[model samples]
Target: MSPASTAAASAGPSARRQASGPAFALTAGVIGLCLAASAVPSPLYRLYAVRWHLPTSTVTLIYATYCLGVLASLLVFGRVSDTWGRRPVVMTGLSGLLVAMGLFGFASGAAWLFAARAVQGLATGIAISASGAALLELRQGRDPATASLANVVASALGVGAGGLLGAVLLQFAPAPLVTPFVVLAVLVAVLLLGMTTVPETVPRVSRSGLRIATPGVPRQIRAPFVVAGLAITCAWSIIGIYLGLAGTLAPALLHTASPLAAGLAILALGGASAVPPLVARALPPAVQIVWGTLALIGGIASMAWSLSADSAVLFVAASVVIGIGVGFAMFGALRTVGAAAPPDGRARVMAAFYIVAYAAISLPAVAAGFVAQRLGAEATFQIFGAGIVAVSVGTLLPALARHRAQHRAQHRA
Candidate 1:
């Protein structure tokens, strides 16, 4: 055998096996819980509006506040996970979630809502980067497919459960608004305590006297970055509309109007999104991207049809379609970027990708809410759905043409 192959073989299966045990599960749990708390309030926006007599547009603004917090935190400390180690930064993020939840449980006005969302955003921003990096590091030398699958599944479950658990808490608990956050805060504290059990995946002092700065992309990788960024943004924009506004829009659109039911619309997407990666193990990134685009087209079309026809069933179906698209696109983008990214520029490239993603979720949805107020809600939704479809289709056609052209050139040669 070659020296490199021989060395790899000599590394021992036992050591590779060690990384996948209890410690990894503990780490995944902590990260998943952190993400869950970030979305727990998604279902509660209606309660806040009812309690405060605020407008739906106001709720979108409140949701937008969370994005702002996430953006600020990412800008300031997105690389902290790389520099300071993932565990400590994650623990800090969880603590932020705990504090945010406490504030939200007791929130009475717009200011409190804004503060809670900001805290949640900051907490999520910190946890997401650290958790993802840590999961990758911990799974090094193991099955890359398994590691990616775990992260994607955990993210889906966490987001889905956030809405369902919050909705159930609101539907059944006494003082629903106050109770869910209190429960989530306590759960976060438990996760926080559990953090001590997991070993740090990223070691301290790796900087070796280097000054850590904002993340960047290498010149050769820029093309992939642009395609990955656009695909990612388009994919996540579907989610932005679902989780950010579905709570308010679903009731009116589907005529259910119950906050709990509306929460299910978002939950449906999250739940359905989680299932695909399990079956699609080891899919190539490019293939996953194509599937994602197609799914987005189908999902958005279904949603538009649902709105036009006033069928809740179709709305639910649309959620599933979109969820599948998100699952494929997100994982595809992650794998593509991670592979294409040179070590030196990985962080910056990832930072830019996330900025686009969160923008997809926050900006367009906020715009939809205002448009709904003026143009009528159904018309506004159609516009949102149509616009997303166009973007997804627009993104897909050029890529497909390029892929075919490349294939033809290769065959001709």
Candidate 2:
């Protein structure tokens, strides 16, 4: 039997007994909530910068700090859920999330913001791994494709909602920073209650202790893994640029002082991101990657031109295009990797994938902040946009070549 079959067989009677009802939707909702909470701070980052008189470099470091915490969690506890039951691990993550939300809501200074974000990252990292695995196992008919699509949609919605909600609260609510987090805290509490009804998909197994190791891709799938990693990394790099810098950048580049404007820009990027997965659900993964990469390249280039020309119309258009490109490319990469992994190793494989992807998301944004401090935001956008274009083009080549080879082989047969 294949490894996936072997893993399913290992689930035994306990797994079958627990596999009834609407667990898929519940798990997916939990995933969405976790991601939304993570994004709640996007609009607030610029406000924090203004309130604390923080430099761009300091702001980026604060953002990257969260990613560091996530990396640490994934490296240490990524596979812990595999040994323990998924529910316990998920609940633990949610508890951590609550603490993070409380910290953000009550934050008084830079230290509080940094600490809150780190805790948020740790909580999100843990929750994402366990929830993603649970979704796969709890999915109706064990459809990996549908599960992957749900994951992508949930992520996009979470990001968009978080940014828009933060914007609205900041504009009208009494306490901008505090109110958004308080709202998220309440939402998370509700999600925690809802999680109680979801079934545990991973059977509890006796293990000696926690196993801490680096997440690794199996040797057989290394080629596709590299392609997927590159695709996701490139796509996330674009997203990181927006998340880390858009709020700050939008005001300066577009000459707008409104927080709502900044928030809407992010919301547009995120909302547009959700479109591709629904539109291209039936396309082959390779086709999706190629088209997505092309869109990424074009979108970045358009943004660069828009910045130079000071065209809000072009900038908005670019954001939408970039969003669609990222959504398609990332979803395709995730589906490819998830489908290739054995059921038992899916979480570890996903953890490994995200470690690389998040690194791409965090590190470059921090670097760009330092560069923007000295060179100016306009120059920085040009430089980062060019780099993204190059990377996307480079990533597209191998995927297209492989697709062509597969087509040729099929034709010959």
Off-target runs (Cα >4 Å) in candidate 1 are 1-18, 208-212, 253-255, 343-348, 397-413
**Span of ten consecutive residues with least summed lDDT in model 1:** 1-10
Q: What lDDT does the true structure give each of the candidates? A: 0.72, 0.79
Error of 1 at 163 (Å): 1.5
Q: How far is candidate 1 from the true structure (C-alpha RMSD, Å)?
A: 3.8
- The prediction achieving the highest lDDT against the true structure is 2
Which run of 10 residues does model 2 get worst, by summed lDDT?
1-10
lDDT of 2 at 332: 82
Write down the RMSD of all candidates, one decimal each.
Answer: 3.8, 2.5
Q: TM-scores for all candidates?
A: 0.88, 0.92
For all candidates, the clash counts are: 3, 0
Candidate 2: tens digits of C-alpha lDDT, residues 1-413: 12446546535444444544456676777778876776677777777888889876677777887889888888888887776767777888888999999998888888887998899889888888878777666542455577678788888788778877888898899888889888988888887887787766765553324556567788988888888898998898988777766776677667878777777888788888788888888887778889889999989998888888888888889989998998888888877776676666766887888788878888888788788888877788788888888999999898897678768998999
